[model samples]
Target: MKFRILLLFAVAFLLLTTTRLRVHAQSGKSAARPNIIFIFSDDHAYQAIGAYGNKFAKTPNIDRIAKEGALLNNNLVTNSICGPSRATLLTGKYSHTNGYKRNDRTRFDTNQTLFPETLRQSGYQTAWIGKMHLNSLPKGFDYWNILPGQGNYYNPDFISQPNDTTRYKGYVSDIITKFSTDWLDKRDNSKPFFLIVGHKATHREWLPDLQDLGAYDNVNFPLPSTFYDDYKGREAAKQQDMTIEKTMRLKQDLKVDADYDKDWTYNRFDPEQKKVFKAYYDKISKEPAEKKLTGKALTEWKYQRYLKDYLSTANSLDRNIGKLLDYLDKSGLAKNTVVIYASDQGFYMGEHGWFDKRFIYEESLKTPFVIRYPGVIKPGSKVDDLVLNIDWAPTVLNIAGVKIPSDIQGKSFFPLLNGTKATAKVPWRKEAYYHYYEFPEPHHVFPHFGIRTDRYKLAYFYNGADSWELYDLKTDPTEIANIYGSKGSEAITADLKVKLKQLMNQYQDKEALQILAGAKK
Candidate 1:
């Protein structure tokens, strides 16, 4: 009996020792993985960011990211629309593959796997704060406080876990920043975290914060050179309804309440809110009425008002970013956390006489992407290689030492950051494919798909209107001239079509393939 008792005691001691060792090994592995913070904003054009050379705006906090880390000069989006771009960033796949192609009130199919889910499974705590306009509750996140639909600019309602919404009072940008920091305070420090701070500032119907109402009042923005584009060569450009002159309204967009033309936007505000808004806008409204501005003068006046409000909204966004960066520094998380700033897609700030995004134009196609990885990436580095929104997932997974799924369409560009050779010496993609499907409603941008190389761009506008447009980017950087069927352009056009077809096949875009076939016939 004594011998049996001694043997049982020895076995129990061995089991305890093994368990403790396993726990210690797991803790060490988690500590080695770097934390990730992805900051996303809506309708923020790369041209508006000071880091990207916007002389009209001040973005010191955003510029700091570029100064501290790497800037992706050629970061482009697969789609230029809102929800589709967000879907692509999460799934690392195009809109067709993810089944959220258009923003016509379609719900994001959350059943499919997302990169955040992969991170959560790998023992990382995940949380998403602020706008995630997916029309569905976010999956794979342990904690989420998101906005419903586009969310209000003031006193937005944040939808929390277990499906409950609570209204918070403040500017949307400031409220989002506060929730993000609060989440950080309550998070489990034992495990590494991946947090997404999404902001809804600078979206259409640009409403500046009350404090920022008169921020840019002193500045008068110059008109874009293409503000008077005749649409002489481009058929699709002529048919769209997103023009700054015609589509933008004085009461609805510019907040000029001259006659009150039944504007529903202002009706949404409460009595107190309306009083404050009227006090500020009513004073400015009298000037335009007194000037009796028309034609060039009227357009120029509208441009200044639009720019002032847009820049004021952007000012709040930049200030909030500073707050988050300060928290990281004070909390000692700056050394190990990888901070990333990006947008769902770029917007048009009076480029080509347009006010909305959905075209495959340069202003809307390119987004600002800045990253700061303290130890891994060298400071002030600039990557000129073409990168897409779809690459975000694979890159983040690779950074966390997580194995990227084989089915993800995007290839990780982590090698570009760390200066390491890929295990497989595959060539990087030299061109990017773009497709926009939303049309005939809202902005009325035509459905088109195209390919963009370093020096050229070719597009096919189909969906009732069959046309081809090509640009020699080196000679026509502004894309003012269409050289598709022009003389001496046969070789380049044929080459671009071949490359476009190859990409369509690679991505398995059956709709695009059918369209290409029809266009060829």
Candidate 2:
């Protein structure tokens, strides 16, 4: 009886050891799956980032992503507006295909297959922790904490799952970072994770943190070369209502006073928030009065204030980004994680004397995109291929080793990170298509669509005006001259039209087709 008891105990110990070894192997396999963290911000212009050659704006943390990996030089957005651009990133499809064309309060179709949904199904935990701006509860995320539309900078409210909202007491950027790091601490370690840290900083009506007040007081930004463009030869440029001089108001935008005008932005602030804001702006308001500025000088003053406040907000954004990066490094997650720093769309940083975006101009059209994927991508790489916001979804999915759906319009650029070709038979896209549908409200930019090639860009503003504008980007890099009907440009224009029509057909843009039909050849 004693010998039989000893044999039973030995068998039990051997089985327990074998089970432990098997579980350890499975956990190691899970770790092999790359984790993805997409850090998206609002209205973050490429030119403002330190890596993109901006001496005025200080963005060391954002630059770190580019330093560690690749920076996409030609990253363009299909629609250069907020909501539509986010929709494009989620669906890997353009505005027309995704059914979210304009930011005129359109609801996103949640039933559509998002890349997050695919990632979740493939044994990954997904979360979105900040400004989603999609006007609806996010779908396909296992965890979601989002801000309401154009979320406030001070004491923002976060919308969690099942339509629950809780106001968090802090600056929006810091709060977002806190929530993101908290999520990382609690995530299931057995599965790979995909998280989106969306930031509302640097958006319109730019508000800086209390500590960042007067951050750019000592600096003076030079006026853009096209500050007094006069809109000669370009009808669309003349018609736009986004000029900094006329559109950006001193009281409303510059925060001179809470009750200076009927602007609705100040109403969102609480009494305590108002007190703090008043103390800061009122002290700075003396400069404008002392200068006794008017006309051009006044315009320059507004421009300076605009840059100051904008960069101040950006300062907080970069600081929060550093916090997240530090957490990743300390936690040992940075090795297997792919970190992407991008914006919904680029903003106008006093380029062309404008404060808002919507044009297919270079300032608004090209978004800032930098990614750091260890082991897969080499450090300090720069990709100049024409990439669009639509490519974000497929690329992330591809990195996770998940099969991309057939309906996704974007071709995964995962191979590009490694200097390899995409598995697709067709060559990488040489031209990028752009379309902007917002008009007659907000900034009053007209609806337009265009195609940009390696050396030229062709835009057709066809909502109210039937006109065409073309630029040879190589010679006219600033796009000051509209050479559409200029001599010796007939052949180039003709070729571009053919390419435009092909893109429209490929994307199934029926509305653009109807407009193209009525356009002058």
Candidate 3:
């Protein structure tokens, strides 16, 4: 009886070993060529993620990305506008260096040796799945993307490369994820792959999936004390077009059925939405503009609408991210592939009484950066070093063994990932230099330049004139009080001005002279 039992155990052990070998063999994933996937979302703020200290935003999958890898607590961008930010990500250069400082600026020059182009040369099958808000067509990527101008919430159209544009009939978030996962399924397995999965959620006129429309409607969100900012000491912050009270869209724009003139709808009307509105308005009832929405009630209504719509959009995107992660594990690609989740730039969610980005404040200055490289990064490690968006290209290039271009302004942070060094320590930019140039835009944000160190930040807003705003970040994390002209601030401002100029020169910025010349006072 004992011999019989031993025989049974031996057979079972052999079977288990054989099964494991067969599973590994049949998976067909390469151990050497690591797949890199960048999941980039639009205007998705760091503070909204569960891992990033947002007490309320439901982002289980985004939080998982951080759990499985490292979370960058101090990520920043050279220029915070959408187009310029994309350019910086692609080229690893600042907006001025990349020649894409303004939304109105021309397309990125393809003449340079882009990271994807290098990866393509190295035989990686690269594909971009969605939302390249590029004014000029994409280049250098092995798979070119076709997304909506800003992408849409429903019935999104994706134009494929070599002249293949297909309209997918579904929500934008799902469509992008499906296409990306589908691409992953059918990719040339002979070569490793790099895919950029971009989402159109949480952008301007935040819309949600049909399932998420009524979320956060019951719980009344507390009003920001700065919500009713009179703009007393903030000369430039007052001129911004991101105020929740001023620039936020209402009614049809927000997908809310309300008693207001439909003509006043603020969101960019989709061609399909126009048709729906015309048919509804021509046959059905029109909402009159004579609605008496008193002060507090009106503001609360807007806040509810904003949270319900915005969080709903985030829900879809996070759900889709989960789908991709599942694919990695189920397909046995988790061990080799590297996954990165980030936003184009940080966004304002009623922080400092604002919604849109393009400010040097904490909400807009800091973006969410999470990465999962199964072997290299330990689970749930958080790094609080200032990293620029441009650093992304070089970091990927370093991981892939492709050389970084001398002209690129960014250095790779790959070493920091493996717990080798402090990211912002070695080539330690004493302070990060930032510039925003799209003025009178959809958000009339004036052009500005600033410097941020470990504790202090100084900014100059010049809308053809000159105005300076300084903040002691340690005391005033909210930036409600600008101490630029305050007495006893001259010494710190002067020190920050010198560091700013030195950085601008290091970055080859010609505009740094403007700051230095104005600092003579």
lDDT of 3 at 462: 77
Provide the overall lDDT of each model, using Cα atoms, as 2-decimal numbers: 0.87, 0.88, 0.77
Query: Model 2 misses residue 297 by how many Å?
Result: 0.2
Candidate 1 segments whose C-alpha is farther than 4 A from its true place: 1-31, 258-264, 267-274, 421-426
Tens digit of per-residue lDDT, candidate 2, span 92-115:
999998999888677899888799
In candidate 1, position 157 carries an lDDT of 86
For model 3, residues 1-521, the per-residue Cα lDDT tens digits are: 99999999999999997887654333322237678999999999887789998777889999998999999989998888788888888889988788888777476676765778778888888888788887767777767666947866777667887767676666788888888888888888899898889888778666666556555656666676667777778777766777656666565445445333343322334566545534443321222233455566665556655766688779988999999999999999888999999998898777777787888888888889999887668789887777888899999987776778898888987767775564334554558889888877677777788898878999887755377888998998778888886999989988998898888898888875665576424
Root-mean-square deviation per candidate: 5.8, 5.8, 7.6
Winner on lDDT between 1 and 2 is 2
- Give per-residue lDDT, candidate 1, residue 357: 89
- Candidate 2: pairs in clash: none
The alpha-carbon lDDT assigned to residue 77 of candidate 3 equals 83
lDDT of 3 at 430: 52
Give per-residue CA lDDT, model 1, range 1-521, as digits (tens).
Answer: 99999999999999998887665343222246899999999999999999899887979999999899899988999899889998887899988899988887888988887999999999999999998888889999999999999898877888998999898876789999999999999999999999999999878788887778888898878788888888878998889998878898887788887333366455445567667877999988887769988887888888888889898989999999999999999999998899999999888888788887888778888999999888677789888888999899999998888999876899888777755534435367899999889878887788999999898999999876578999987988778798889989999899999999999999899999998998942
Count backbone overlaps in model 2.
Answer: 0
**The best candidate in terms of lDDT:** 2
